[model samples]
Target: MTTKATTDDTAVRTSVRVDAAPEHAFEVFTAGMDRWWTRAHHVQKGELKEIGVEPRAGGRLWEENDAGDVCTWGRVLTWDPPRTFAFSWLIGPNWQIPAEDAAGSRVTVTFTPTDTGTLVELVHDGFEVHGPGWEGVRGGVGSDGGWPAGLRQFAAAL
Candidate 1:
């Protein structure tokens, strides 16, 4: 996995590999984000109803709950088929404030085809503004209780 903080210094990036084709891996990752993502660890808890990715640049990355409330988690910044996808990552009060009229941090996921399978590189930038508090959020999402387990689930679904 590859990880780095933004130039401003408040976010983190993490990448990992999956045993699947690039296109398939990308589909599994985005279409099945909710399935593998740990429900218990979600910021909204049991209230999280659905996680949706619109599959295009400027598409919405959002969640809804049983209460009929919809919250935008992010927006697609770049969408290159079978190779790369970039979006905003905003959750919780801390990450909600826009850095420059833009909501949350930027997360880019790149898929590279390898002889064995696809290598998924996730880049989550923008966090230095939040300072120490961002660490907890980053750490939480990195642990087994977060994205790792979620990505594993995504891979298993394929």
Candidate 2:
């Protein structure tokens, strides 16, 4: 079964159970990020060539296009493999990178072992950082085509 709930106005939470171990689930979600990311969700004009998480705290979370242009999404805040991963989400309400990193939000994903599989929970918060158009940021991520759908794709990959 899938699960999703809003913790507050500023945050969106979603989860899914995957038929895989916590380690494997985490691997696919991070190391295999490009495989599950929604192609149409990107802000770039070129086709997405790769989506990457640099695997360390403070490392870059970015995506590259076919033209070799790179868009920096944010920085990794936490990288406890197979357990927890958190990163700054720097895309603004305009669907573009903001003028300052402070305008971004945060995303955290936790992997917990379950009897049947791994429970992967994701939370994207701090929408208020977007300031004037913060609601749009919150609404977009909480929409059906957002985190919930992304988690579904992640589960399907496993």
Candidate 3:
């Protein structure tokens, strides 16, 4: 994943490129974000009940816990099949960062075909004034870290 510092702001942008078909890649990435997303790495680990995406603009990206409680992880901001999808990243209070300032961010995943394979890019944009922590989260949870493993699980499912 590519993590960059903004020129005139405290926000950060992160991206990743993957090798897979566009449709396949997109489907896998979305469907599998929960599977390979480390339980130990999540804020609602033992309590995590269910995780899923609705696959449409205005659809819900959510999770539930054993207590029959649920939370909105995000909403689908844009949904273009086989091409791209953008969602609100409401991982605020769920993260190690301070809740008061963790207003959350955006996650945009784009799929493009190349001569060799598909290029999957995941961008996490927006951050508070705290620089290193944001970068650390982006780097830790993206690319071959969390999402990639999820993609691999998705591929296996297919």
Residue 129 deviation, candidate 3, in Å?
A: 9.7
Error of 1 at 14 (Å): 3.2
Q: Identify the candidate with maximal TM-score.
A: 2
Q: Return the candidate ranking by lDDT, descending.
A: 2, 1, 3
| Candidate of highest lDDT | 2
TM-score of 2: 0.93
Two-way TM-score contest, 1 vs 3, winner: 1
Off by over 4 Å in 2: 5-7, 100-102
lDDT of candidate 1 over 1-158, digit per residue (tens): 22222222344445566667898888877877777665554444346677789988989887776777766667899999788988877653353423334445567788899887887777666643345577665665555545555555666676
Q: Write candidate 2's Cα lDDT for 1-158 as tens digits.
A: 56665656868998898889999999999998889998777767778888989999999888888898888887899999999999998888888744544556899999999999889999999888767888888889888898988998888887
TM-score of each: 0.77, 0.93, 0.66
Per-candidate local distance difference test: 0.66, 0.85, 0.60
What local lDDT score does residue 7 receive in model 3, on the 0 to 100 scale? 25
For model 3, the superposed segments whose C-alpha errors exceed 4 Å read 1-19, 93-103, 129-158
Residue 7 lDDT, candidate 1, scale 0-100: 25
- Model 3, range 1-158, lDDT digits (tens) per residue? 22222222432333344456678777776776676454454454456756779978988777766776666657799999889889876665336323433455677777788775666556666744234456655554554545555444454543
